[model samples]
Target: MPTCPSPRAPNGSSSAQLPVREKELTRQYDLLASARRGLPMVRVDRDYIFEGPSGKYRLVDLFEDRLQLIVYHFMFDPAWEKGCPACTRYVDALRDLSMLTRRNTAFALISRAPFPKLETYQKERRWDRLWGSSFGSDFNYDFRAALDEKIPTVH
Candidate 1:
């Protein structure tokens, strides 16, 4: 860790305050990560199928024999003219997947849009990750990523 000398601020605060704050932030982040790692895992038995560029594929197929699989639920509704910008931004971080692959982990993107639309948007965005479509599938609904049409009105 690097520490900088704290110069006196206009309010008479020492510049050294930043190092303390950074250390505190780092400690909090470590604690949060430890708690996250302690969370329980839920086994998924549902055989959900998704549309891929080549053909339909089951959820396990995305892993490609990897020990772990990470599925990113992208916001690309069937009616939308384009994919969500925020979700697309997430893909930028995955440009270099060598680190993840070395750890025996696989990553895939799933959306509610049709395969053709996903393909078009993926090409436009130039994303190299595997993208799948959950259209006509209960995946989005079951995963709580998409809302159902029937909302029970409160009396």
Candidate 2:
């Protein structure tokens, strides 16, 4: 009997695919799709204030009326001593994410950094992706990314 070559994972390792039950698969998919429904339809179309190199822009308008929003909430708050390297990696990879808007999906990065601060960081890191600083906004609070004083730091 001949053996077949296993599929290679992105990490250059061979891993066997896991088996799945058809019924359970269907249930998982349905639950995920339902998350987008049963909401008061928070108008994700409204343009919010955002500044770029050229000038200011309404954030939602940049997507050109796409499938709502795909905001990448980041940890660029002043509370942190420095920008997160993990977050930096994500932002660096995100420069090529224009496809999201091309696929009719609005894409943006939300950070607590002031626009000027973010601009400085971007220049230092050589980041060229479209990003926005949500200064003076409750975006972090609304999205539950805000730091909780009650929660103790494990590290």
Candidate 3:
């Protein structure tokens, strides 16, 4: 992760000289972050299976013994030949995320597309991040990442 730059005044002054509005906005942003951290957590009871390069794996396996797992629900519909352009761009913009491992967190990309397609795309893009396929599983629908009229949501 990149470090946040210290706030600077328009006149090349210190952050202590920042305008009232900027300070207020920073305070509001901090409060919102605190609220998000305080939100209640839900336990996942369902066992979701995913396909990867090695083989099929359960949802808990994606954690890789890390304290937390961060999954990026990349939008790649089964019928589509390629991933979403926006999602591709976002992945392209990502920097080295190895820093996350040091924080006891693991990250992976989960898509509804078949594993073969995801593997080919990952190789073509030269991305070494862990990618998994949720095809034939309710993982995406249960997480509200994939939408389909035929599949009933698990509200």
Candidate 4:
């Protein structure tokens, strides 16, 4: 959703010195992004499940009839009393969920906290997006979002 600036003449002002190679690089990046969408998907056999707003659901269920799903692995540990402040801030940026739904894509959050605690933190942040807990499951580990049992220092 960004517009490309038009190339300026040699006599143009100082700020108008955008390189022609930059535009070509941008085009190449866009092509790569388009190609990434067509990458082959490996079948998942594990019955990984999560606790959701409406009971428990599997990983595929998170897609919610959409072909593409974006799951943000929130770093909220089970022992933490409150959700991560940084993750909370990132969630605040996704206020408009309709944009993704319109594009046939769904987005959700998965955390390591238990269902009840995850629910409480979500309520405190007043978040409306779909969130689930991977507490009794290996969803986080399988996805490599959670590294071992140690919680990383945020500071």
Give the best candidate by lDDT: 3
lDDT on C-alpha atoms for all candidate structures: 0.84, 0.67, 0.88, 0.83
Model 2 stretches with alpha carbons more than 4 Å out:
1-40, 44-48, 79-81, 150-155
- Give the C-alpha lDDT of model 4: 0.83
Candidate 1 off by > 4 Å: 1-36, 147-155
Which stretches of candidate 3 lie above 4 Å from their native place? 1-38, 149-155
State the displacement of the C-alpha of residue 21, model 4, in Å, after optimal TM-score superposition. Answer: 19
The deviation in Å at residue 83 for candidate 2 is 1.7
- Candidate 3, residues 29-49, lDDT tens digits: the string is 999889878979999999999
Which residue pairs does candidate 3 place in steric collision?
A: none
Best of the candidates, TM-score: 3
TM-score of each: 0.72, 0.60, 0.73, 0.69
Over 1-155, each residue of candidate 4 has an lDDT whose tens digit, in order, gives 99655555346655365666679899998998888778798888898889988998898999999989998988899999988788889998876778888999999899999989989988988888899999978778776687475644321
lDDT of 1 by residue, 1-155 (tens): 99664455544466557768889999999998898789799888899999998899999999999999988888899999798888888886666888888999998999999999999988988887899999988888776777356632111
For every model shown, the clashing-pair count is 2, 0, 0, 0
- What does candidate 1 score in Cα RMSD to the true structure? 7.2
For candidate 1, the lDDT comes to: 0.84
- Better structure of 1 and 3 per TM-score: 3
Superposed on all Cα atoms, the candidates' RMSDs to the truth, in angstroms, are: 7.2, 8.0, 7.7, 7.6
**Model 1: which ten-residue window has the lowest total lDDT?**
146-155
Q: Which ten residues in a row have the lowest lDDT in candidate 3?
A: 8-17
